[model samples]
Target: MSRAAVPRMLLRGWAIQVKDSSSFGFFIMSSLIEPVIFAAIAAYMFRAGNRPDALLYAAIGAGMLGVWIVTLIGSGQALTFLRHAGILELLIVAPVPFVLVLAPITLAAATVGMYSLAATLVWGWLLFDVPLGVEHPWLLLASVPATVIGLGMLGMLMASVFVLFRHANALTNMLGYPVWLASGFLVPVSLLPDWVRPVSWLLPTTWGAEAIRTSMIGGHPLPAIGACLGLAIGYFALAALTVRHFERLARQRASLALA
Candidate 1:
């Protein structure tokens, strides 16, 4: 494939995955349907507390929760799917390069998260009468894709690492709730324990959530958005290196299975 064809390939691959995954019943339940329940629960809790901004806060947080969950599960299992389907080797040997083939999967995973975000917000507004006021509409719009790209790159890093492990699902299962909590998806980072603060700082979801919330409520979101983009660059570079190493190991082993 020509150099110019790479972007098209990535976009085409991402589009196909978005379509494929959306059609999957489990994906719809996990990414969209279940998250609305979480948001409803949060809304009830906040309504009980009688906090003024409760519904909106719960809605946004719930959306972010869905976004993280979809991206995490989808990216975590991406390479495993390829291996199980017996196409990992063919893609590895293809002239297009494996990283490009893999990246769209992660990106598509993150893209699907957007569905949760939108649905959760709409669900909140329609059901709970949550206000849809925006402090900075443009920033909120920009933050959406920034959040997606950042999470997608982090997913790339995760997928690459998981390629070296046989029980990647265990790690993904372990990480889901903890990452959302740590990322402040449904809580303020400042409210978390001081020791946990450092861990939250290192997560792309942290910056993404913050950027989004700040843009919506009333604050400068640019710094958090910049942080998301910066982390995207770092995560991409690290994932590239990790994938290169995984490819080397796979070449010697001739299989993705653990010895």
Candidate 2:
């Protein structure tokens, strides 16, 4: 694809998403509300006696969790809806690259996720006086593209499964809770069972959360940064391959009604 065409494709995808404001609002609000509630409770509970940093840590956790969950789950559901509507097939037939076809849907989901993070941060600061700082501004800056590519690839991987099984939506929902729990957003990873720690390492959310936490909180160098970045890049590479494989399968399996 031409460099100029990329933005056009993204804009077109975004425009299609914005046309459905009610669904978008519902999707955004649903993801935001629960995290806000949990953050408030965690802040209050952890900050009850002393330790001002407790609220900050709680807010950080909540914000990271909010973005992670919204992007993964929202994008997966959006992709499934688009596929059911036959938009995925239509887009594949378009001149744009397959990856660009998923952009608009992923953008919509990421927008919702970022909005949720902003809301949580604002609410935490205003209500609890939680203070947040970026100790490693450069690292934090690098994380934005890393997160977008990593999570976008994850969403594509999940979406591809729908091509093989109509019931993959159930799988997304099933995996969502466990993925969230494993990411240590609600609790610290150090507290997790030893056996589960290895599994958590395999999840993108874990790396994303760690990166955010390390950047926001000043403690020590983030030992997981290299691992996180490497794993995220690898995951996206695999996701791209999966998208191609599934797109071909989808084309072959399309019937009159499916089309």
Candidate 3:
């Protein structure tokens, strides 16, 4: 691809997603509703006296959790729908690179995930009076894009993995909550079992949650930001390789047509 090719593809991909989302009232409504509900519930649960800290933690955790879950599910569902509608093959055979097409759609889904962040902050402040007082405001702002891009890459990785499955939608939906739980977004990694901590550490969500929380509560964000950025780049690289490998296998097995 030329220098301008990827940028043009990204803009087109993002526009397509925006148009589709606007055309479908369900997407627009659900994107607004889900995050607000989740954040409100979490805020309510932690609204008891002498728990400003807990409430703040809940707000950020719940928000990030919503982002992760939405991006994961949305990305997988987008791919599955494309397969069912016989569009995945066309995308793969398109003139531009497939990752260029896929990445923007996932990022667009990540854009919806921003609503989760907004809803959490809004409801937390409105209902619970949770103070925003983030010490490292710039760091917190920086972490937002890093978190979204990291999670988008995670979704891209999942897309590659799901391409081989016939009932990818079911698996994608089923895995959403479990992945959030394992990421320890709502809870600290220290609370998880010893065996699980290692796995959680490797996840982008873990690094992302830590980064955001650290930025919010006041701490050095370099470690967390570094891990988040590093892992996101790593995931994107792996996703590209996985997609290439899977495409080859699909062609050999004559299964790309089936999806």
Best-fitting candidate, scored by TM-score? 1
Q: Estimate each model's TM-score.
A: 0.95, 0.83, 0.88
lDDT of 2 by residue, 75-103 (tens): 67655676567666577787776766765
Q: Model 1, 47-164: lDDT tens per residue?
A: 7886756787788888888888889888988889788877777788899877899889999999898888788889988988877788999999999889999999999999989867
Q: Which portions of model 1 miss their true places by more than 4 Å?
A: 50-52, 257-259
* TM-score for candidate 3: 0.88
Inter-residue clash pairs, candidate 1 = none
Candidate models: Cα lDDT each: 0.87, 0.67, 0.76
Model 3 local distance difference test score = 0.76
**By summed lDDT, which 10 consecutive residues of candidate 2 come out lowest?**
218-227
Best by lDDT: 1
The lDDT, on a scale of 0 to 1, for candidate 1 is 0.87
| Whole-structure CA lDDT of model 2 | 0.67
Model 2 spans > 4 angstroms off: 1-4, 7-23, 48-52, 219-228, 255-259
Reference-based TM-score, model 2: 0.83
> Candidate 3 regions off by >4 Å?
22-30, 48-52
